[model samples]
Target: MLQRKFDEVVKKEFPNAKDAKDTSIHYLGKMQIEHQLDISKVLMATSVCSDDINVPSTTFFNVLFGPFVMGGLGGVPFVGQTGMTAFAHHIPDNGSAFIFYGPHIGITLEGDLGKMYRPRMEETGNSCGALMLALSRLQDNDYTPVINDDDYQQMKLEESLLPYRDEILGSDNQAKAITEATYKIIDKKIHEYIKTCKNEFHVDKVTLLGGVIINTDYGLDDYFDARNFEVIDLKGL
Candidate 1:
């Protein structure tokens, strides 16, 4: 039902996105143009890893929450209601900095909300889809695994593999390793972009949107308050 609703929404709003592979970018580009949002105030990340795409969402939930829940952790709390979790929980209980670590990652620095960023090497392929591909190789004894929306979602929600939860959710797991590595690269980029926003662009507050924010790892409390960033759900706008 959720998938159907998302499809319908995409179909209606993105009629011109016929050849566009990443629907999130298409919709977000449209939204940015429609609302005249300031690109300097927004930073976006996604698994699409395409520099051509603009600040982006439904694909957000699939990538962010699908792994944890399908790994048998169960659905995230309040996710269905607000479509975003706060960034507080992702931090260590005593930690200060918020580190985002999700698979199939992509980072984009948008300077103008009305325009799209050109493809850059640093902004693409910072993801764990390779790991997923490897896992698929082991499972199917095939050399290549085609990573797509349906396969990724099914892999996350597969119940027969529950016994392998340790492998999927372990502290030293491949998923964690991929997320950490990707985060390290993207974190520096984000800080650099944030610095530019503050120093050059004179932008103070950051606005985070997209389905990736819905994961339980994110929280809305003191963490963001300390950083002075705001969460803006596109659904509300």
Candidate 2:
């Protein structure tokens, strides 16, 4: 498992962190943990960097998932770079962190979250890094941000997919219906990812952060069954 792999690595690098009961990760890293894990509630936050062009244009929506559930910034400086760096230094080394990169689903989501989160990308100047700092603060054991097999399955449920309510519905040609084709493609990939992890972990809830996630056009809370998964809009807080 990714967490196990990470925990092993952390044990070697920061031995002192093992004692800390809590830690935090910044920038969401490369892994994640499902809400079903036996852990305490950790604070999740995201921001819209004043500058955003540095982020690749292909995987914006995927990026939102990392920060929202784990915690971090988008692409700005103080909000993203400096903040993430500082946050990482403070975490006791036992907690977890999650960071999202824009290129993962940039081409897939069609830049919807990117344009919506910071409509005036030209004006923001790409300084979104608060969440990144938060992720960096985590200790490998204290926090686990990787997304495993179980987490992927829970994310597929109509309710789990609700966080992306806007992308599923919109005003442009891309925004119409959750077509069978699109769902099929997403479902295939999701199922494939789930086959490798522990069965106990599941994406019961999703936390959203970053400028792109916050500025999204669809109000997931409005249409989706909030009872299933709570969407934590982590833009300002």
lDDT values, one for every candidate: 0.29, 0.27
Give the per-residue lDDT digits (tens) of candidate 2, residues 155-180: 23333224444554442422212222
Clashing pairs in 1: 84-214, 85-218, 86-218, 86-219, 86-220, 87-218, 87-219, 88-219
Please list the residue runs of candidate 1 whose C-alpha ends up more than 4 Å from where it truly belongs after superposition: 1-48, 51-172, 202-204, 209-237
In lDDT terms, how accurate is model 2?
0.27
Worst 10 residues of 1 by lDDT: 216-225
Q: Least accurate stretch of 10 residues (summed lDDT) in model 2?
A: 219-228
TM-score of each: 0.26, 0.22
Best by TM-score: 1
The residue-by-residue lDDT of candidate 1 on 44-90, one tens digit each, is: 33222221221222333332222211011111111211112222223
| Candidate number achieving the greatest lDDT relative to the actual structure | 1
